[model samples]
Structure formats: structure tokens, C-alpha cells
Target: MGMMKRLTAALAVATVLGGGLVAANAQEVVLRSADTHPDGYPTVEAVKFMSDVLKKETDGRISIQVFDSHQLGEEKETIEQTKFGVIDLNRVNFAPMNGIVPATIVPCMPYIFTSKENMRSVMDGPIGEDILKAFEPAGYVGLAVYDSGARSFYNSKHPIKTLEDLKGLKFRVIQSDLFVDMVNALGANATPMAYGEVYSGLQTGLIDGAENNWPSYESSKHFEVAKYYSLDQHSQCPEVLMMSKVSWDKLSPEDQTAVRDAAKQSVTKMRELWDAQEEKSRKIVEAAGVEINEVDPAPFVKAMDPIYEKYADTPELKDLVKRIRDTQK
Candidate 1:
């Protein structure tokens, strides 16, 4: 538990000193959740839906107040805030978490997940449960994993039909060494930048392009500047909903169960919204004259061999990668 979390729990208990244990259990608690994505985004809306479930489950005693669109901070900044209990909950991609959590690196690797369906299957099973458990020792209680669809390369320059087209091109990537290495391996120069900064980076020519799912490219309005979108579909890393251990410790066991259950149930809503959002964004971008192309994934997959070898060196990671590969598609 973090110092802030401990202090928060202590303060809550102190306020009802004379009321006994029942009063503490009955105390109304509202947790603060953070998301970089704007309102109506699937991840944001899903958390909102979870809040509704939690309120119903707890008889309105427990609720969540979401702060979306970087209202709190960017992903990297909010992650630290969540850890220290400055933020109660967070929804973040696995890339930003790679350096801090080893298990997250496995899923963030390029070409590791064959398709969205496969990725979801792997993450919703025992393997996913194991990965979720990995968060606890690192200061989070992972609740559920949500879909990010498939990520493809999009740029302001020409369509990347072949590996040769990407050579020497500069691209913005999330703040992760694996992401940097992955971009560099594909024959491009990787510029580490925040998600919020990518739009300006693209418009100002600070970067040639970036990689992300269709919805993100559309929602962030990056598609307006980056006209070429190549469907390499390189990565299918999932998004995670996590609670600060400090905030978690403050909840009674029953309330904790309610939170977990509600979070799990929210995945259904997220996936439905995500599927619809992907289709809608694709249509909008296509209508806007964004050149979208499908590339031969064979060459891209071949390029990732060295990346896999470098990152999945440990026996634990090797086993995890193998299990994910062996999972039924």
C-alpha cells in the first residue's frame, strides 16, 4: 500500500470513530477514475457503465466519478498518480506499462497477437488471469482487460506497402523501449512522445506519422493530418482497468467483490462499442479521403523475430509467449 493510500484509509476510519464498524461499512464512497480518451470513447463510456453497475451492486453506497480526456493527466502521468492513490482508477494501454510490469511486455510485442479475436481469447482465459495477477506486486489490482482492436501504421507520407517504404521515416511511438525498438526494427526512426502530443507532432512535421487502432486515429483527428494508413495490423495489445492498491484496501471485502465484478461485466459493453467504433471510424476516414491500404503481413512478421528474441529471453516470458501463441485462434 502507498503512503497516500494508508493515510486516506486512516482518515476515513478516524472520521467515524464513535460510530463503530457498521458505520464504516455503510459509509458512502466515490472513487475517482482517470482516462486519457475523451468522453463517448469506448473505454471512457465502459468505465461509466461500470460505475452504474457498482452503484446498483452497492446500493448506491459506492460509485465512480470519471475524469476523461486527460482531465487528470496523460497516461504516463496518471499511471503514477494511480499507483500512489492520487487517482483511484485508471484505464491504460500495455505499452506505457511495459517498463514497470514484465507481464505487460509480452502482449505489447509486435505481431504477437494474430488477430483481435485471438487476443481477446488469450486475455480472457487463465493466461490473462495470470497477467492480471502480475499487477498486484507492482502496486495495482488489475480488474479486466479490454480490446484495443488492431494497430496499424499511418503517416503523413506515402502508403507503406513494403518494408522498404518505411526506411528512414520518422514515427511517433508510446513511451516504451519495446515500442521504440519495434519501430526502429521495421526500418524507421522512433520518436517517443505522449498520445496527446502526437497530433501537433504530426501537423508541425515533428513526426511523419504514428501507429494506432482505427478508432484512435479517427478520434484523435490524426487521420486529418496523416493521409496514408497502412493496415499492417502489427500489434493487438489490450487496454487494462486497474485500481490503486491503496484505494482498494480502503474498501470492504464485499465492496471489493462488487468492484471486480462490475469491472468484469463492463468488458462486454466495451467490446461492443469498440467493434462499432472501429467500423464507424474506418468509414469516416475513408470518406474523408484517407488512403488506406492492406500490406502483406508476412514481411512485417519476419521483421519481428529479433524483437521477440531480445525481449522474451527469460524462461518466464518465453513460456508466456509460447502459451499465447499456442492459444486457439
Candidate 2:
């Protein structure tokens, strides 16, 4: 927050238009945003769009600089830094955030959302507001939730057509206890590895495969080695736009409104970009010769029952699941 105050004098620029500065003199406040995906990935694109929106919405008084492709550090480390006020902003999956804010894990549960519409209803309404508030106690200010699409499994060994097909396969997962539990519940060896290490792990047979959205499978070029992508559609883990509480507290009320509004507006744009990217990435991977398969989610859902029960370790999480399932568009 102190950082932004020092720049207020330097940015006496005008209205922002056509990606250019126009009229009036305003204080310039530049904040940093971070993402692990490459430049074009939907989450990163959303961050860039949010930066633009922030500049324009605030009349060039505020701007954001984004770091993509893990330029600063891995997800967990940067997440902690954001908590401590070292990092101003972070775009990360809700899966890892469950530990710091339990309400986040409710929507991230496997098979939780019936459709994107259903998800939007939950994330943009009361439930979303509740979770965002829940984040306040954890040293984070939840700005918005971005679509992550669905995470399906792809492997070098074989196609996952059924629950039995998943057994004995080594799959890379985020270093989250919930994900580890979910993978193990499916009878697979959950290999928790860093995102950058996944390719080599798959190539060297250290891991048989991994689960992720279409863009990731194509962008990371994992499809080249792991030729079989199973559409288990296990979870729609949304990405969270988080600002450090320290930074949030530092902002003037007007600046806070600008940043928060910009973040929320970016969600609509991000989803549009995400849908197109998912389709494009899927087609690209298929043309690259990756065999994409679909599975009846019933068995997979049934298999996840225990994990769901395990997840209801607290009253808040239990109520969260019920509310999300009950939410309607």
C-alpha cells in the first residue's frame, strides 16, 4: 500500500483511451499482478485485460504490471508472498487456496458444478460474496473468480475409459492435499509435482500422465507425449484473483472501488476468452494426434463420494457444498 502512494505524484496523465493517455492530471499507482500461465493463457489474458480496465476505469490513476509464466516464483510461494504483502496480486487456482480459506474448496470439489451457468450463479452471487469475505481473514482480498474450464486426465500409458483404467497410473497433480486425496480415491498414484517439472516427469516415465484443462495440455505440449486425454471432467477449479490484504488496506476508498470493479469486470471477459481458448486448444491437440476420450461421469462421481465426505471436515465447508449445489441461475 505504501508502494502505491509514492507513485501518485508521477502519473499526472489524462483519460485513458485507445490504450493511450488522454487528458486530466491524476496520481499514478502501479500495482503488480502475477500468473503462472504463459502470456496467452486465459488467466494471464484476463490479468492483462484487468490491467487495461484498471487504467481506463481509474482515468489513468492506477495501472497493473503482470508477471506471467512463473516469472516471480511457483504458485504456492507467490501465494504466501501475496499473503504477507510482498506480492500485490496473484491469479491462482482455488485448489491450493483451500488451506488458507476453507470456503474456496467448496466450489472446487470434484463434480460440484453441473455447468458453467451453474458455476456463474454460485460464483457471482451470494456464495461468491461469502467466500470473498472469507478470504479477508486469511490476509487476502478475493477480487474475482476466473474460469479454469474442466480438468481431464491425459496419460502416456493408456486411455481412461473407466475407474479401473485409472488404477496404477501415476498422475501429476497440484501439491494440494485435496487433489492428492481425490487422485488416491480414484485408485491412482497421485504424483504431486511442480507444473514446470511435469513434462520431464511424463517423458522420463516418472509420472504416467497429468490432469488439466485443454489449453494447458496443448500449451505445455504435454499432448505430444501423453497422447490420450480422457474427458473425466472431474473438477472445474476456478482461478482466483487475489490482492494482498496489506495492499487492499493501503488503497484509498476510491482506488479500492476501481480495482475491485476492474477485477469483477474482467471475469466476464475472461470467460469469453476461456471458452474460445478451450475450443482452440482442444482442436489443436486433436490435430496434433492426441486421442481425446470421454467417460461417463457417474462412476467417477460415485468414486469421489468418500473424498467429498472427507472434505466436509468443517461446518463451513459442509454448508458451502450444500449452498453451491442448491444455487440456481
Cα lDDT of candidate 1 equals 0.87
Model 1 / residue 318 / CA error / Å? 1.1
lDDT of 1 at 140: 93
**Tens digit of lDDT per residue, candidate 1, span 217-290?**
99899999999999999989888999998788877898899999999999999999999989998999999999
What's the distance in Å from true for residue 184, model 2? 2.0
TM-score of each: 0.85, 0.84
Q: After superposition, how far is residue 2 of candidate 2 from its true place, in Å?
A: 24
Tens-digit per-residue lDDT, 55-99, candidate 2: 888777788888899865667777866775656889998878877
Over 4 Å off, model 1: 1-25, 193-207
Highest-scoring model, TM-score: 1
Which runs of model 2 end up more than 4 angstroms from their true locations? 1-26, 204-206
